[model samples]
Target: MDLNTTKSLVTSKTFWGAAVAVAASVAGLAGFTVSAADQITLVDQIDRLIAVAGAGYAIYGRVVANRKIG
Candidate 1:
């Protein structure tokens, strides 16, 4: 696919919607887990999970979008 096609797909509602959904779910889970504890260890774990999930999504989108462009 060409750059135009890739841009079209990346900028589409579906792609954005999915990304947002994934991010939201990760955040929600992290928050829920953290809320159950007052210790720094649990909070750090939740933060780490959220960060990993967020990074994964970002990398995934970048790779997929680049593949489509190429």
Candidate 2:
């Protein structure tokens, strides 16, 4: 709801674990046919995007957690 509450969730292991699970499922589903060609490329790109998003969330959580509440 609020910024602090969201930050707490983002900083928690459960949140990241869920995120990883969702990301992996999406990526795995897309290339489940085992085309093993462009499908690998697609999965790689999807994984990279997910990793970037997770890194961004972690950075944002750190920033928000360090902010002085006024």
Candidate 3:
């Protein structure tokens, strides 16, 4: 994947927002309340984790790649 894809993983708020919304909905249905601040915190933490994992995977791919770009 290209760097833009990795950047998107870090910067795409819509995707994360939708995920959090679904999770919050599920929590609400289960009789658990998720506060706005908590949702924001969850998004921030998940974003950071995704960013780190994406970067690591990119680096690993480069290291293990057997072919060269033209």
| Residue range 9-69, candidate 2, lDDT tens digits | 5445555555656666687888743334554565566567667999998888878795765
lDDT of 1 by residue, 4-70 (tens): 5554444345554555556656778788432223344444555566668779999889877845554
10 residues in a row with least lDDT, candidate 2? 32-41
Please state the error at residue 49 of candidate 3 in Å: 1.2
TM-score of each: 0.38, 0.43, 0.71
Clashing pairs in 3: none
For all candidates, what are the clash counts?
A: 0, 0, 0
The superposed Cα distance between candidate 2 and the true structure at residue 54, in angstroms, equals: 0.6
What is the lDDT, from 0 to 100, of the residue 48 in candidate 3? Answer: 91
lDDT of 3 by residue, 1-70 (tens): 4745554544677788778989999999999999989989998998898889889999999899999857
Model 3 sits at a Cα RMSD from the real structure of: 5.0
Q: Where does candidate 2 stray beyond 4 Å?
A: 1-35, 66-70
Best by lDDT: 3
| lDDT minimum window of 10 residues, candidate 1 | 33-42
lDDT order, best first, reads: 3, 2, 1
